[model samples]
Target: MNPRRQVTEHLLRTYKSALIGFAGVFVVGVVIADIVAARVADPAPGIWMYVAIAFRYWVGIIAVIFISNNLRQFVAVGVTRRDFMAGATAVGVLASVAFAVFVPLGHGIEYAIHGGSGFSAATGFREFAATLVSCLASFVAGSAACAGIYRFGAWGGLALVIPALLPAAAATIFLTTDSDGQIAADHLSFPLALVVCLVATAAVAVLSHWELKDVTIRRSALG
Candidate 1:
């Protein structure tokens, strides 16, 4: 099997069950929260609106685990470090795009199930774009952070914490979502914010690759 496909498929398979459970829990939890909110709060807020914030962090966690745990295993099995990075990048991109769509789609589904005027196509587009960039940034940042720790010890890794956070921080600050589900920037124009987010993601991705390419595999047990 191709290394890229092998990594992609392995990561996807590893998360398949967890992803389904998360979806199930998210759907059920949001519905219950909406019901409870509708009864208690006057003009209940959209449950999915706030709940969707977890999606980016979730992507980040996946990236962290991918770098921290799977890198050694894949390399031991004969995958080159460059190939592992390539495969992991492919997985990150797919996951970023998946949750980008899932976030907005889930929000729409939540609104449709309850009673509310749906968000506009423009609002949805903003949400989609913001989520895509944010998730991508999160993924790269997570990998970079973990790669630092993997390459260096605990104290050494601390030095990289702030730099690793830059991508996700830039995304969160620049392409943030508003209450109305639109992406908003406090000072920067929409185009500029998008550019900043993409640049940050790309930079961190490069940093992650640099840190990981020749990283020592700390453990030998595949278990």
Candidate 2:
């Protein structure tokens, strides 16, 4: 009936399975996507880099999805915002290194044939800043989803990601005319998305915490 003991074990089992499933999906999805893209279109320069970027981007989302579904059980003082940030930094650093190594090698054929990775090549602070911002955007969105889904429930989290996306989804259908490429880099609307996502996350976190306050383990055990 110890809350800490129960929650810690719960988090470990849930996250372990989620992480493994995510990895399997990522590997299968990327390998197939790469082979198909190679066969279909003789893409422009940087195509391989594009492939690498696509995989990494999608995997990041998938990671967030898993974390979102399972983090709420462990959000005590030790897992506060500061602690989350520190952990995120360590994860980000490791991921970035892996990307740097794998990308050049994996996309070697595409580069050898076409030339470069057509994606935005970050050279200076501006590039670094942009990358950081995108990561922040994902963090906010993921945090919100995590709080809503994990703390509250899946249905509650879906309520948030869906409703928040409505306006943007409508505008995307209305404004985007230049193929589907720029749609992925939709920076102009990211701030709005971040706000929506974070608000939803925080709301769910606060409410769920309040809802369960009186039902803590000691109270439950005595009952």
Candidate 3:
């Protein structure tokens, strides 16, 4: 097998249990939320929408923490930084895509149960693309923050997190509307938001590579 593929597989395997657990929880949570919303006399649009959005952000933050904590183990196992980064990036992108699909699917399921009481889960292909790009950008931003912490410790990590988070924040703001039903894309066009998301993803990847390329793995105290 290719070294990068091996690394990616290993990383995926390491997180398999957690990912599965998250999926199970998300599904159950959405179902419960829908049930509660159904009982309400005046349920708002997209009753389960917040649940879906929260999951994406949760996954993003968790992805970074997982990568940061595991980098040393990968290095100890003789995986080159470049290969590890490649594998990690692949995993992040794939995971983002999976969630992008799953979130809307979950919403659709909820919509069916609720008799389509809310705004369409994902109205069009443009919305779906935006969701995917937003999720990907968020993950990349998180990875960049993790890389910063691993490379430069806490204070340095704090300094780096701002730029790293901007892309994800921008994507989120532009792609989503407030609870009041004001569409963000109305202010900033969908195409422009998509462009920003892509740029942010690229920038974070570059930043992560720069941080990890010459990094020294610290020996764990417990080891």
lDDT winner: 1
Report the number of clashing residue pairs per model: 0, 3, 0
RMSD of each: 2.4, 8.4, 2.8
Give one digit per residue, the lDDT tens place, for model 3 in 1-223.
7778987788788887888798898778767766676677556355555666665575577557656666687778888888877877787777777777776666566666666444363453444576688777788788888777777888877899888887788777787743322345566676887887788788886887787798878764112
Error of 3 at 63 (Å): 3.2
Per TM-score, the best of the predicted structures is 1
Any runs in candidate 3 off by more than 4 Å, and if so which? 42-45, 118-124, 177-185, 220-223
lDDT of 2 at 18: 62
Candidate 1 residue-wise lDDT, 1-223, digit = tens: 7888898889889987897699789878988998998898766668886778778888899888887788888988999989888888888888888878887887777667665435767777778888889899999999888888888867777798789989899988887785557665677887788889899888888888888888888873121
Q: Which candidate order results from sorting by lDDT in descending order?
A: 1, 3, 2
What is candidate 2's CA lDDT for residue 209? 39
Query: Please, what is the TM-score per model?
Result: 0.93, 0.41, 0.87
lDDT of 2 by residue, 161-209 (tens): 5543332233333222121113344554644644543454345434433
TM-score of 3: 0.87
Output the worst ten-in-a-row residue range by lDDT, candidate 2.
214-223
| Candidate 1 segments exceeding 4 Å error | 220-223
- Candidates sorted on TM-score, descending: 1, 3, 2
